[model samples]
Target: MRRIVAALGASLLAACSTPPPPERGPAPAPAASPPAMAPAAPGALLQREAAVWRAARWDELPGWEADALQHAWPALLAGCARPAPGWEPSCASARALDSPDANRVRAWLQQRLQPWRVEAAAGRSDVRAEGLLTGYFEPQVQASRKRSAAYAVPLHTPPADLATRKPWYSRSEIERLPAAQAALRGREIAWLADPLELLMLQVQGSGRLRITEADGSVKTVRVAYAGSNDQPYRSVARWLVERGAFTLEQASWPAIRTWARANPAQVPELLASNPRYVFFREEPLPDPTIGPNGAQGVALTPGRSIAVDRRAVPYGTPVWIDSTEPQPWSPTPPPPRPLQRLVMAQDTGSAITGAPRADYFWGWGEGAEDFAGRMKQPLRMWVLWPLAHTPGDAKPISTR
Candidate 1:
């Protein structure tokens, strides 16, 4: 499958200032009859349905006053570098503020933005704006510069002629075919131990690799989404579930590893079930604090960056998420706590297709992985846009 590649950088400001107005000419005469209703422009209607956007008061946004807005400051600023339409004014104002104070940032947002509640399209009795919320994170894996007995699996880079072919080669073909093997002979970026871990990294699109160098010096580097063969993606876990190896609820990284250990002979067949293959490129870790590039071309914030459907919520827009922690699937799940907070629509994913769906970024390492792996719960969202911004002819029901 072809994965999207995004650029990362830091360059955003807070929305504490106002933009200059556009120069206008003399007012025109009133229309003799009400103007005919015009067709909506591109990206006007949310999801091309009757999705109602009820304007909300600031107080209606749950936990708005208590959230630590400073955490999302970096993500907002990075998005400002490539501000979207209807967002340029707010981005410009934000560029002028340098302070990272949470109170000041929260105040600026309250002053300039109008929050709208996303509702299901009218007449669709079965639909509701509320949908599933999940999480994804950058995983850290151990690797080596040279292919050793311990680290036998190799992570390949895109070949010189990768773009020339429509679908390069399937994962099985690459391992079995001579021509496919030749194409990736010298394109190894790094070697890893577990094939399952490498596949997980590819599925997530990006991750951090902890490598031991030739001289025994260890260093950490980012392996971001470079490109992939255009084959379709299939879930091996789903395959396991269908085969009765485990139930859907019991499917996870640890469970999969246990299955692999029990059925060592089926490892190759399990991997070959999915035809898609991903190639990666190493990136420099300039600022260890920042994360890999998101679809909006900005560095993601640990708790404040979320992947949203671009058609429903435009990139660079502020989104308020009201959800609960996912229920644990084991001996005991974590207590269901409120996950209300402010986050930015700074990324996107193929699976995130609807308006209410979102994938929260939880940063990197084990803690993030643990949370991200289990985050699948119901979600409600409120989009904060510039007060003057309007999607189409839809007027705000109320304003704060």
Candidate 2:
């Protein structure tokens, strides 16, 4: 019945599956051990998550999203031993390197990356022309001497690119969606943001997204995308209803679109009002806890996917991203051979799981962040294990 809402959930649904198994039954009531530290509050949890994501200078550092996903996807995939359907239980399979999950995912992703006309006709997800904006992220670049962390640089674009706001949906991999590309042909979606492979629609660029800590220290972040490839307008309106925005009748796509268009300048205001929209991306473990690791993580140059083996690929491990998006996205040139790196798969979302299935971090820039939210396509990944395999790497924790 609904189109966009389904579109919105499509991405996230692929990453996180149903809530994780309830802690293997609560640790047998903790055996009356010494009292543990108080758990984090929802707000606090979110704040902590935000603070962790903000690298030295700019909030939307290139590989931050990748780092975040690197933190959580493995666990989720390890947990999702079997893939199921329906909202009740999360659906995912342990796609080990060269496993069936790997095969299916890679094959599907291969089709997705192809020309829109060929694959667009095949039902998959969807994309539409939108605006673009400059995305910025500071990595540790070289200087007079050795390596060091540096502030983010301005990866620029005009405001119009960050202003265009429409998600184009393709039909099923078996059938075309909305089949409106012809009407919407040649539409350029200058979409950008910190994508985690799913739900990229709502995170539209509005205001400055800053990560503030308890002590009042702040790291201001400029997101990249006008990311609206989220769930349908109705879904957002429904979420709004949950947050006391409107009545059921008003929670329709038409109503929401009209309202969104009417209050164009206020979209950020409306979006910010919904707490559901206020989400925190999580990073993988052994996070270096903000030490001066200056971890060299990978950069998600547009149209690319990085790999991670939770046990193997440590977070903040910067690696060069490799993709065949041809020119435009990738200037200079790609290596004669595939170049892979250990990026800081720092964050995690509800959807991203499986060993091969990766979270293409879209960083926190306005446009980039929005674009990252609604991305729900299967991605192929080749986790770059160390060139010189270590003893411990041999017996990697069973991601089965």
Candidate 3:
């Protein structure tokens, strides 16, 4: 009996190990490999942008650009025909848009943009704040040589800006608009940035008042305003853990928010212990004026961060950003490259609060939020600040 049982077990194991036969129907095809793609880099982005700028301004290209388009347009167009995914190479192959036509397009774009001057005030170079350093904004072009007074103290405790939308209590008019809640939630976004970035937003109010005495007396104690800033989620959480707000493992958003709320006054102190960063986002960004792969407005899709060599960086330039960084978001697409290179720098947030810094534009949703929260790495890039210009005064590189 023992010998028979041992033999039965071996036979069963063998039966299980045998490969299953293919189905009677046609066999399934093997999984195909994704198309080959160039690894995304800032340099690649700059090259594409430089090419277009040179090509688009074919007439104005002074040096090598004019030569490339004249003699090498054919090969270049061929190389660009099979433009990689998310990259729109249509501009490159715009049906032989000879010099005159290309120059026309270039001229059209230049005319569309308006340059405004930031009138300086004759006040002291340094102004006093409640405690920390702060800034006052003047968005409009003034007539006289002075700053104007159309400011509001951002609801945010840290210094805040007018354009920087906040979840206004709306309690005042909440009953009127039912759709307001959804609209507010829709705009909620998150991003990751460096800790040490300085983001100082301010308002032009004399000071806030408090009811210290009873009856008819009130106190006019000055309130110091702080910029609305975020500690890269990672950095902020780490600080929280060190300060006994949470344990290393217990560090989490909900936990952090709760602790932060409980010690509202301590929130700034907690965040300041680490490097603080300001937020940046594109304004008038209903649609992007530029993108990674030369897409036009509204068509501005998401892209990864690319390091630019500031010397060549240009506003509204297209670029391909590698989309490979994995987090609590998507299962990480095979290394992201050249999805788009963001050219605008006036967005909100801390890490990106510098001129030289590029806030990689990760489109909407939770994945972007997760990416922004956990992000904290240096990137390499190919900058596309315009190389050839007729006479455009570009914004200076951030002096952070």
Compare the candidates by lDDT and give the number of the best one. Answer: 1
The TM-score measured for candidate 1 stands at 0.81
RMSD of each: 9.4, 21.4, 25.1
Q: Once model 1 is optimally superposed onto the true structure by TM-score, how far is the C-alpha of residue 93 displaced, in angstroms?
A: 1.7
Sorted on TM-score, highest at the top, how do the candidates line up? Answer: 1, 3, 2
Winner by TM-score between candidate 3 and candidate 2:
3
Full ranking by lDDT = 1, 2, 3
Return the lDDT, model 2, position 338.
26
Q: Return model 2's CA RMSD, one decimal.
A: 21.4
lDDT of each: 0.69, 0.26, 0.26
Off by over 4 Å in 3: 1-238, 241-255, 261-268, 271-301, 304-312, 329-350, 353-357, 384-400
Compose the digit string of candidate 2's lDDT tens values, residues 220-291. Answer: 432222222232232344455566644542333334556666567755544433222211212222322121
Provide the lDDT at 246 for model 2: 49
Query: Across residues 40-80, which tens digit of lDDT does each residue of candidate 1 receive?
Result: 23223233233455567778788888888887787887777
lDDT of 3 by residue, 71-95 (tens): 2223223223332222122323233
- Cα deviation of 235 in candidate 1 (Å)? 1.7
